[model samples]
Every structure is written in C-alpha cells, then in structure tokens.
Target: MTSPPLSDLTVVKRAGRIAAVQASVALALVLLVVGGVVFAVYLRAQNRQIGAELRTLAMTADDANDPPPDMELALRENNGHISTSDGGEPGVPLLTGATGFSDIHANGREYRTLVVDRPEGRVVAMTDLAPYHAGRNRLLMALGFAELAGILASIAVVVLLSRRSVRPLANALALQRRFVADASHELRAPLTVLHTRAQMLAHRVGTADVRTLQKDADALVADTRALGDIVDDLLASATMAARKQARDRVDLSAVAMSVRDSMASYAHSIGVTVNLECESADGTAGFDVIGSAAALRRALTALVDNALGHVHHGGTVELRVRRDGAKVTATVADDGVGIDPDAMATLFTRFSHGAEHTTREGREPYGIGLALVREIADAHGGDIAVASKPGEGATFTLTLPAAPPA
Candidate 1:
C-alpha cells in the first residue's frame, strides 16, 4: 500500500498547505531561469537584425545612383521627435525608436524601449517565458502532494502491526499460568496417600502380610522420598526464579559439613566413604555468608549424590569449604569415570548427560540435579563450575559471596 503508485493516487486527498508552498517555490525558480535564457536569446537575435539593416543602408550609399528620397539628410528633428515626413513620402519613415517590444511571464508581462543603434536608435525583442513556468508549477504541485501522503500511510501501518504482535503474547502467558495452577492441584493428594501408606507399613508387626509388607514399605519409602525431592526442587526453582538473590547470614561451611554427616548412613550402606574439610582465614570461623541456605544445601546435595554414585570401592568423596576475603568456595570431587570435556559444556543444563549416566550401568542419570545446582548459583549471584579429565577424576566448585557487614 506504501508503493509509489499508491502514494501518488492518495496525494489529492492527503496533501495540504505545505505541499502548496513547495510547489510555489519550485515554480518561482523555474520561471526565473527560463526568463534569463529567453532574454539572452532575444537580445542576440535583435542585434543580428540591426546589423543587417545597417549593411543594407551602407550598400545603398555606395551605389552609383543617388540614394532614395527617404534617405535624404534633411531629416526632421526637434528634441528627438520626428513629426515631419521625408521629401515627398506620404507618411514619416518608421525609425527603430517608434517600435516597442514586449516580454511575457506567467502572471504578468513587461515592455521596454528598443534602440539597436546607440549612435542613432535602439532596438529590443520580447522573451516569452509564461508557458514553460505554468507547466513547471503544475508538475511540482503533484509531486509535493505525493510525498506528504506517503508519510501518513506509513504511520498507520506501524500502529496496526504492533497490535498484531501484542495479542498473541498476552494469550500464551495466560495459558501457561492456567496450566501450572491445574497440575499442581492434581499432584498433591496421591503423594500424601503414598507417604502415609509407607509409614503405616513400617509400624505394622506380626500382621498377616508382615514379611511382604516390610519389603514393599522400604521400596515405597525410597521412591516416595525421591519423588518428594523432585517436587521440592521444582518449587524452589520457581520461587528463586521469581525472587532473585535472597541473602541472609547463613553459615555455608557448617551447611556443607552438616549435609555430608546427614547422608553418612546412606553412603555406608552403599559401600561409599565421605571426607569433609574446612579452612577459614583470620576474621572468619565457620565461613558464614549472606546467601540462600536452602538453595545452597540443595545445590550441594545434588553434587554429592552425583559424586557418591560414581566413586568405586575405597574411592573417596571429598567436601571442602574455605574462604578468602569476600569469596567463599566449596568443592565436591570424586575419583570415578571422569567427565569428558565435551559434555562439561552442557553439564549444568537441564536434562544433561553426566558420569551417573554410565557409571551405575543399570540406572542412567535423570539429569536435572546439576542443572538445579547451577540455577541456585545464578539466583544467589554466584556461579558453579566443573573441571575434569577422562580416566583421572572430576571436581565441581561452587563460589559465593562472603557475609556482608550488618
């Protein structure tokens, strides 16, 4: 619709006072230039005609016979007026002074005395510039109107397109909000029922189905706990994503060690070992920090679980805590099927492959654990990084801000 053809058609209705002014200016310039050229050509032609007339008089004077009666020296003159006739002529001979010339312009016309012979008389010619100027004014008026019309159409199109893009975004966001609300409601009851049944089986003793019930109870507890962890992680992610950098006075060093101690019994059952280390500089004790404790522990546990699953018999899992000035660092490393450098790039991305994918043989890594760790780091205004070489070992680091002044 904004094409040149369309804009020109739209001009008659759209163009206004400004277009009219532009057309007037263009017309003025065209008239001035044409007038100058026409005037110059007229002067040149008149000069040539005057010279030819003079040559004809000179030839008449040189002829053997006497000059014509009209050419007699007894010419009548008084204050440059010639009222008398020549010799026996019926009327006075027309001199260059008696004839006048005219010039034409678009709106008006001009006249002037023309005397070609300065020594005797002067002659002049007319410059007809009116027709060309009229044509120029009409052409400029049309183009000025077209330019004004194009600008208005472009503005209308931009407003329409903005409305088109905004509507779909508003609808998609509303749908996602509705979907999450409905799904969370559906998940609550089944999980609570499963948790209660497992506890009941743990208490029942000498009941008719006690033997079978005991094994069922243990499996139910493990799976239910795993499911609970996944749900909690998801909730935490949503919360932290919404509320960035929730900081308080949290003892990071104690949190790391406590988490390791809590998992001791579980590691022992799986033939795994744990070692915890702490190093605090002056003005530091347990490496307290202004950070998110729940998020930090969640991140630590995910890395620990990954480490414990990979380490072999007698192979150790180390949790180290330390601080340097404003920085607090914690590391979890294990001697296992070391991660490949290529996979390290996506190691913390959601659903990425890891050492757990291959080391456990039967059970593949579900993949969100490390992803959560990185998310927590980002939320706390920190970061998580990993370094590994195949056949050697792997180390993961979590770096956070030290506690701030109250």
Candidate 2:
C-alpha cells in the first residue's frame, strides 16, 4: 500500500529538521576527531618528558643524599647494601638488580623509575607520577568540556543555518500549493458558465431558429476560448519567475465589463443580476492601469463569482470602476447576506468561509477565489479592501496604480 501524501508544510518542516541533524552530526564528528588528536599528542609529550627526566637523574646523580626536586634516588652497593635520598618518600619501588627504565606502582601512587649500573655501585632514579597524572586529568577535563560546548554550539548553528537555507524551499512549496488551488478556483467559474451555455444550447436545438442556434454556438465557443486563456495564464504563471513577466496597460473599466459579461449567464441562471458602472476623474470612459490583462480579468472575475455565490436569488451584484488621483479603484458590491464582522479578519484567507448564507443552487463558497484576488491585487502593486455589516451588503474595493499618460 502507498503511504498517504504529506502536506507541503509537513514536508518542508521535516526536510529542515533532517538537514539540521545531519549538519550537527557532521560538525560533532569533526570536533571529536580534533579533540582526540590533541589529547593523544598531549599524552605522548608528557610521557616523553617524564622518561627524559628519570634518565637524566639516574645517569648523572653523584649522591643519594641529594636528588632533583620531586625525585627520589636509591643506591645499591656490591655488598647488597641499599640507601635512599634524604627527602625520598618511603613507598618508592626499587628494582634491586634490574638495569632499565620501568614503571612501578606502590602505596596508591605511580613512579617512573630508571635503574643504571655504575662502576662502584648501582643507581636507581625515580619520580612520582602524581603531578603528571593530575595534569593529564586536567587536560582531559578541559577537552571534555570543550567537546560538550562544541556539540551544543554545532547544534545551535546548524539549526539556525538550516532554517535560513530551507526558508526559500518552504516558500516555494507554499506558493506551489497556492497556485494549484488558485488554478482550480479560477477554472470553476468559466467551466460552470460553459456548462450552463451547453445546457441552454441543447435545450434550444429542437425548436430554435438558425440565428438563435448560431448565437448559442457562438456563446459556447467564447466561453471555451476564455477557459483556454485562463489555463494558459495559469501555466505561464507557474513557469515564470515573479516580477519578471511583461506587463501592459490594462483598462479597469474593460476588465469590469468583461467580468460582468462572462458571469452574466451564470448569474442569470442563479436568478441574480450582474451590472457594471464606470467613472473617471477626467470623465473618461476607461480607467487605465499597468498590469497583466489576464491577471486583472481573473481578479475581477473572482470578485464577481464570489459575489454571485453569496447573494440569494434575485439579488443584484454590481461591478463599479472609478479613477481617483494616481490610482484606479474597482469595487464589487453585492446586496446579499452580508458578511459577519467577526469573519472579516479571515475573509481573504484561503479555505476560510464568511457569514452563513443561503446559497443559490447549493453552491456554497469554497473561499479560495477572494484569496486569489487579493494575491493578484498585491502582485500588481495594488491592495484590496472590504466593508460589510451583518444585515446590510458587502463591498470589496481593489485599488491599483494608474497608468501614466501617453
């Protein structure tokens, strides 16, 4: 059996955590290897220095009564007599006849001993290993603390770096999911319009005149072409990078009119009326804005579609466009069951619903269309706003930069 598919958020989070752990482990291993090398070198040097000191004392000492600091000397005569230095401790292990370097442990302490044979007698030189052992212990303790600190630091650094490195991937995944959802929502309205037109064409085929048949066929073709355009636009958006696409002058009034026309059949089918009103600061017919025409149309279509979904039968949905200063504003207003004040905060959030309404034809709002509209408006260097009350109507206004005059 196949495993259930993971969400984009889950995949991104898991990937980031895995990357952090792998990086932390890698850094920890490096620290361990370095520390091990340093520790090994320290032990080797300490042992070598101790051996040299023992050899020196054994070969050059003349009297057992005087020995180097922290060292003990023992002399054995041919007659088997034994003696120790004045300051020597009692527990130094002395090899009677052995004549080489060796280690001796006695009285819970360690000693490095060197026995040398001389002309008159035998000499034994010894040094306590306690201080050297203490030094080694100190070094080990320091290394242990350093390793702990290094591991902790590595974990922190790796987590921070991994989050920074994976942030772009996370954003891309989020955008991909949003794109798919937006595409699906964008296609729904046109598909519905096409389906409605097809049904009408089929019903009129039996008794309709040739001219009427031609009109229905034309309408179906136009809807299909519009659907194709939406698909192409979505595909282009997916493949292209942001802020790099070519933009041209788009008339907000024209977009509003087109949205009203496209949604007319669907709205009529649901017993709702769609209207368009345009005004300009200079009393011009068109309000020009610089952006992608297809995107602007999609944005307006989403607004109208959302309005149609919420409004009851016989309700009026209006598309109003006007120019103010350097901005062109288009508003979609509907006399439907207005949105609740509490739901306004999340109205543009994907997959969020608004106030309860008795939808026409069982077409409940899926809550993706308005979110896409907001994104489109943002992409065009514009913003959207809404005003609504519980019992009154709702108005969504999209404002975009006006195109400079030719």
Alpha-carbon local distance difference test for all models: 0.60, 0.81
RMSD (Cα, Å) of model 2: 7.5
Q: TM-score per candidate, in order?
A: 0.51, 0.58
Q: Which candidate comes out best when scored by TM-score? A: 2
List, residue by residue over 126-210, the lDDT tens digit for candidate 2. 8888899899899999999999999999999999988888898888888787768776776788788889999999999989999
lDDT of 1: 0.60
Clashing pairs in model 1?
114-122, 114-123, 115-122, 115-123, 116-122, 116-123
Candidate 2 colliding pairs, count: 0
lDDT of 1 by residue, 150-225 (tens): 4344344434454454445555555456546643553455467576776677576566486778677766766666
What 10-residue stretch in candidate 1 is worst by lDDT?
A: 83-92
